[model samples]
Each structure stands twice: as structure tokens, then as C-alpha cells.
Target: MPGYKNPDLEYLDQQGNVVGYGEVKTVGDADQSAFNKQLAKAVKQLRVREDVEGKMDVNEIFIQVPDLVDAREVRGWFRSYQKGRLHHGSDLEKISGYHVRVYTGSGSKLADVDLGVDADGGHYDESTHTYYSSNGYSY
Candidate 1:
């Protein structure tokens, strides 16, 4: 726990269980370095929560960016980047067991784009700007 990083945002449910963790980055253009750094930090935080603390209840991990392109680039980097187990790439992939979400928005506004699955195993519907899971639940 001494060396573990902390995510920008940690969402918890009513029961105080960690439901998700998020990292927010507002940057100019698609800067891979900044994106990777923030993402890596979030992933490491999640790793400590999951692997070290045994918090298996966390359901999702997300990265929020002001630019959609940056979000896409971050997603791409997560999919392709390679690193050791305790490093960025692998830590990110590990947290993705609960699925990774990349939402584009700032402040407290509803996200313009939600790029991941919802709680019920369904993908976000871009057209409706809504999340519809396989169990017919919409969020």
C-alpha cells in the first residue's frame, strides 16, 4: 500500500463498495505520454485495490478525457501497450476484467460518448447516448 498510486475518482455504491475507478485527463490534442501516465496511475491504483487489498467487488475502471480523440488514443494504448506485471500496460489489462470505460466529457455534464459496457453486460449505445445492458437495463 505504501507504493500504490491513487486514481482521480473512485465511485462507490450505497454499501460503500468500490464500484469503479476513474482517471480524468484534460489535455491538448492526443498526447500519448500524458495519457499513458494518467492511465498507468489509475491502473496501478486499481491493481493495489484488487490484487493487494483483495477488493474483488470493483466492477469497472474508466478514463475520462475532454477530447474524444484522446479517449480513443488512450483506449488504443491500453489495448496495445506492453509492460511488466507491476507496470502500466499489464496493470491496465488486469483491471479490464471488469471492462474499461472511456467517457468524453468535462465537469459534471453527462458524457457525450460512453465507450464501454454497462453493469448488465451490454455496450453503450452511441446513438442514444445511453448504456443498455443485456438484461434490458438502461443507465
Candidate 2:
């Protein structure tokens, strides 16, 4: 703690209690080309939170992305990005927060293949998993 700077921001609960540390980062990319780089920098900016997490009532690291781009657009791009990651075996877990968004897309035809096995299945055995399409792929 002596040589490290703390996270730039503090997250507080409704009662004004410190809950965690993080940063409010903005992603200006309207396309996928810079999304990964922007995301990595945002996460790196939160590294200082490691100092107090789980030690001072700080249980998390947060990276809040401002809606510089329209929410719908950011979400659309993110969904497509996620699908791309899955298709290539990339991990999205490193990004902060639990995502409830579905990553998938419906095929042009009944037999058209997309994210998984013919737009009906994907990377793993998802026969029983509930899926919703987003950006033309299934997760």
C-alpha cells in the first residue's frame, strides 16, 4: 500500500459506506478495432483496487463504461464482440461484472449455421441451455 496508488474512484452503498474501488472509464470506439485495447486499459486502470479489495470492505473492482456511444450501439457491438470471442476461444470473464446479455444470432434459414451447430447450437453442448440471439450469433 505504501508504494501503490489507490483506485481513482470509490463505490459507495446507499448509506454512504465504501463498498469497493474502481474507475469510470469511457470507451470511445464505435467499432471493434479499438474495443479490446480500450477495454484492457480500462481494466488496467483499476489495478490499484487490488490494494484494498476484501481488506477494507472492498469486495470488488468496478469499471463503469460511460454511454459515450448509444447504449444500443455499445450493446450491439459488445454482443458481436462476445460472439467473436467465443468463436475464437477467447475469455470474456476478465472483464468486470456479471453479464446477463445473450450472445447469439438466428440463421437466415432453418439449416443455416451460425454460432454453434447450425445456428441451433454452438461452441459447447448447449442443447439444454437457454439462448437468445444477438448480433447474428448464439452463445
User: Tens-digit lDDT track for model 2 on 62-115?
Assistant: 223333433334334445655665777856554324222221122111111121
Model 2: ten consecutive residues of lowest lDDT: 107-116
Off by over 4 Å in 2: 1-5, 12-18, 51-68, 80-139
Question: Compared with the true structure, what per-residue lDDT tens digits does model 1 show for residues 35-116?
Answer: 5566556556666766665655544445555544532344345434333333533343344455445555553222222222
Q: What is the lDDT of every predicted structure here? A: 0.49, 0.40
Clashes of each: 0, 9
For candidate 2, give the lDDT of residue 127. 62
Clashing pairs in 2: 104-134, 104-137, 104-138, 105-136, 105-137, 105-138, 116-121, 116-122, 117-121
lDDT of 1: 0.49
